[model samples]
Target: MIVPSSNLTMETELPRMLRAREEAEPGDRFVFHSARARMQHVTPEQLLAMNQQATRAAAELADGRPDVVATACLVAIMAQGPGYHCTAEDDITGALRAEGCSAPVVSSAGALLSGIAALSARKVAILTPYMKPLTKAVADYIEDAGIEVVDAVSLEVPDNLAVARLDPADLREHHRKLDLARADALVLSACVQMPSLPAIQPVEDEVGIPVLSAATATAFRILTELGLPPRVPGVGRLLSGVEEPAA
Candidate 1:
């Protein structure tokens, strides 16, 4: 995984879900590797700078010869403008290829889009740890992809580490602020570093809608890219190998 220097939750939450996967698939073992991109805040300038280091990170992660590679910061790519995830993935692929690494790449930005579509969600509401402007960028990026963003709530945390420190339990409350009545799905955590793993299932059950976070979406993409079933226990609908649990 390629993660921001200050991101603390991706390593924690991603492994938590993958470890749970071990319960269901005891034969499948898992290991984690990451390369950090320097970042301390969630601002556009900082995100852009953090993104610039992804290719290098990709090369480093590829050297591990992992089956698949993924990026953890979603809005970092989204804030780059709509559809930047493709470009980011392409760039990372280029770097890995240069290192003679052929691992499949999954960008969290693209994975979030894919996960939502896999659930057949056309309209959605999202919660982000970024400021309102960055949150708007995320919503616009999704909207440009033909998905409707019925509501978006920004937690307004600028410090990247602070975003990681946010309590996942609080997401149960934050999600209620969205106009979920018009949404087919709910993105509990638009930012991977925001730590929504614990709240995802609970919120989905209460709201009677599909719930997913950037981390879970990335996990789904990673497993699928490896030609494995996307099923992972207890993270949310996208990784549950279900055809939209809300339905």
Candidate 2:
């Protein structure tokens, strides 16, 4: 996975979500390798500039012989408007190909969309650690991908490192603030930098809806694209072998 230099949650949560069941053999376990695209803030300008390093990050991840690579930034891709993951994925592919690597690539933005679709989610509620403008952009991006944003709550956090410092338990109040009456799914962490994995299942149990985060969705996309059984327990409903039409 490739992420912003200051984003810390993906590296921790993604690996936990990707781990196979304990009964599985060693060969069934998946290892993750990551590279950072220089970024220290979650603002639009910095995010747009961050894409300039994705190709280089892809090339660096390619050096590890990874079977799949993912650009693990949600708002960064969504900030480019709808359907940018295709172009972004193509850019990474070209960069990796140039380095004699042909591994498939996925983006956190696309993965989140795919994951919501897999859960058959239509109307959704989302929580983000981004400022209001970027949160609106993320909601617009998700809506453009065919999901309705019924409600959205932004923590209004500006500093990238501070987002990483937020405790998962603190998200419970934010989750309750969303008007989920008409919502079919809840995006607990629309930004990968914010910690939400520990809150996902509990929020789902309380709200009685499928809960997911960018990190869990990205791991699901990676396993699905790799043709592995997309089953990882204690994460959420999307990873429980849910199926949808291919992207």
Candidate 3:
């Protein structure tokens, strides 16, 4: 797994998910590489500019020849517009190919949408560790997928490190504050930096609906694409096939 340099959560959470995979064998492990990007003031122009350099960094990591690489920034790519993950994945794949590496590419944003769709959820409430602007971008991206963003709350944390430092308990508290009355599902937490995996099942049990985070969704998508069982017990019902696994 290769991630953007500014990413602080994937390194920790993704490994935990992979390690917790009940069916994973010893050799089935995950490794990560980070590419530079700015987490503060994430604009579409800035994100695109950062992507050019980030992909180059990924190309360097591709030299080691990972079986697959995941672009971990969700809102950064989604800020470009709807369906941008396809283009982003293509670009990264092309860059790897140019560097004599053939690795499948996946994006966090693409995985989140696919995960939600797989659950057949149409209305959702979201909790994000980003500021209002970035959170809005994420909400818009999901809404573009034909899913209704029933409600959303942003922690307004501007510092990337600060976002990563947030307690999962606090995130669950904020998630509990969101208006989920009409929501068919809850995006429990969307940012990878927010440390959501630990709170997923508990929050779902309390809210009586499915819950997901960027990390869990990405893991689900990557595992499904790899033709492996998507079950990662204790993460959430989403990965355990309580709702539905990705097709």
Candidate 4:
């Protein structure tokens, strides 16, 4: 995974989710390696700067000969504006190919889009860890891609490290605050750095709709790119291994 330098949750959440996958499929063993791009605050300047370092980060991960590479930072990609995920993924893939590693690349930004489509959700309510402006930017990016954001709640977090320190359990309460009556799905945590795995199931069960996070979507896309079923326990329907018809 290529993650922001200050991100603390991706390494923890991703491995835990994959470990849960290991429980269901004993034959699939896993090891995680990460490459970091410098970032400390969740501001636009830092996000763009951090993204500029992707090629170098991808080079570092290419040495690992990873079967699939995933960029775990969601905001950094979206901050570049709509449709940036396609460019970002292609750039990372090119970097990997230059290193003689022909691995499929995934970005959390693109994965979230694909995950939403897979669930056939036309409208969504999202919970994000960014400040209001950034949150609006994320909502805009998604909306420009054709999904209507029925409602969006920003926790207004700015410090990158602080976003990681937020308790996942707190997301359950945040879920209650969203106006989900018109939402076909919920993006429980729009920012990958903000942990949300533990809350995914509870939120889904309560709302009776598809629920997913940037991390879970990236994980599902990773397995999908690997030609494996995206069956990971405890995450929501996207990774339930049972495929849903696309929108």
* lDDT order of candidates, top first: 4, 1, 2, 3
lDDT per residue for candidate 1 within 40-156, as digits (tens), equals: 878888989999999989888877898888988898899999999999999998999999999988999999998998899999999998889989999999999999999999999
Best by lDDT: 4
Give candidate 1's total backbone clashes: 0
Of models 1 and 2, which has the larger lDDT?
1
Q: What is the C-alpha RMSD of each candidate to the true structure, in Å?
A: 2.4, 1.4, 2.4, 1.2
- Overall local distance difference test of candidate 1: 0.89
> Which residue runs does candidate 3 get wrong by more than 4 Å?
22-46, 242-247
lDDT of 3 by residue, 44-96 (tens): 56667766665676777688887777888887788788888888888888889
For model 3, the run of ten residues with the poorest summed lDDT: 34-43
Measure candidate 4: CA RMSD: 1.2
Candidate 1 to truth, TM: 0.96
lDDT of 2 by residue, 86-141 (tens): 89999999999999887999999999999999998998999999889999999999
Give per-residue lDDT, candidate 2, residue 110.
91
Candidate lDDT (C-alpha), each: 0.89, 0.88, 0.79, 0.92
Candidate of highest TM-score = 4
For model 2, name the residue pairs that clash: none
Clashing residue pairs for model 1: none
Residue 201, model 2: Cα distance from true site in angstroms? 0.6
